[model samples]
Target: ITDWKLQKEGGAWNHCSSSVNHGYLRAVIIALYKKGFTGKDIAASKIASKSTIYRIIKNFKESGSIVVKKASGRPRKSSKRQDRLLKLIQLRDRGTTSTELAQEWQQAGVRASARTLRRRLLEDGLVSRRAAKKPLFSRKNIRDRLIFCKRYRDWTAEDWGKVIFSDESPFRLFGASGKKLVRRRQGGRYHQSCVMPTVKHPETIHVWGCFSTKGMGSLTILPKNTAMNKDGTNTSSESNFSQPSRNSLVTNNAFSSMMEHLAIRQN
Candidate 1:
């Protein structure tokens, strides 16, 4: 007590550094008691509160140890097995929302709130994020794509040079590549729900063009009501060709110009 020091700041005593270790506190209390110091005197030394001093002395006397025993609290709502089941449910359908997952989990005998489910998923390293947007492909489309790939698999670049590649694409004015959120682990980018299927016909303007290995072609912007013919023929003058009398069957000015340009370039 005689060698004790306290820090002073702003003309006031700050007792922040006065906190001592539990074992050191117990030893100090015991030492003071053995030295015939009363509780008030021991507390006056500014070592600890009178309550803490008394509690430490009582603990040491009754339990022969100043260490506090552990106390049990509320248990977890979910068990390990239930946690694993929750992970499986999420993996089954990564696009399922928390509420939807909760409903599905009810069938599996686990009752938990959406918030709790999210917490459990986070613990298992599963994150809910916007799913990647991908073009919707039907079974027929997939089969056709496979066949096309197989058919062209052996074609060399020179062989492909003879073929003309043409397509019409609609450019959207206010289109957003929005995505859906899904729960998935790392390296699950290509998972079923993670790859969003899109089937949207957004408001756009159709632009037609064609290209070959030798040269490129002019782009023709079609009118709003222009319906492109499937048999390489223009349906009407609404297609806005440069000349409708140049050829009756093939009236696509862009396609004709592309052929003429490619022919000149080839010569």
Candidate 2:
């Protein structure tokens, strides 16, 4: 009789006239009853009303636990295993719409509606979010970036200062369009699975610029669809910054050569 504890089983509460005691308070009530305290004594002890105490004792005697019986209702439509399977399917493709999910779930023998699917996902900590926009990277781009990092991982601050970084970027004359939705948990906004990859839009213009510890380099506008070589040659300008110098460390790219030249001249 000493083992009564708060039950973790999920169930609807039967409507009752009095607020039910739970946890330690319920434990104390049962303890007093086991100690031969009368229902009147338990009530007079200010624990619960006489009827409530008597009901508790009756329930405890008849049922091994004092947990209030749930009000009878229709059972859950899906089993725990089905719910888990639904979660797995949703995670397999975060972009799947709830309607699409419902169709897939029906194939798996769980005929839940889109609303029900959303409810189940919410219970499992998955919510729909507008996917974060990330620049699409090719395998070659990723490999080159990794190589670049490893090559310069040990470079000092001064070494970096002597290097000018430049890159060309496209800006859409209009604006970025549309959004995609993905299911994700909290704090996973930038997860690869939760991102929408994008490339340069068609109706856009490209601009190339360079900067270094010395100062900002000249801003140069390039023709639409102009190819930018790694050596920074095809889109060269008459500006002094674009002229390659012998002090170039990494590339003949205008920025590197100019920054290195400036560094040498200053020294």
Q: Where does candidate 1 clash, by residue pair?
A: 131-180
lDDT of 2 by residue, 40-100 (tens): 7777655445787788888889996867788889777689999999999999999999999
Q: Which residue runs does candidate 2 get wrong by more than 4 Å?
A: 1-74, 133-142, 174-203, 224-227, 230-267
State each model's CA lDDT, in order.
Answer: 0.65, 0.67
Q: Candidate 2, after superposition: displacement of residue 5 in Å?
A: 43
Which segments of model 1 are wrong by more than 4 Å?
Answer: 2-41, 44-46, 54-75, 103-112, 172-204, 232-267
Q: Which candidate wins on lDDT?
A: 2
lDDT of 1 by residue, 163-229 (tens): 5555676665444455467889999989886776554665566777655565655676766635355
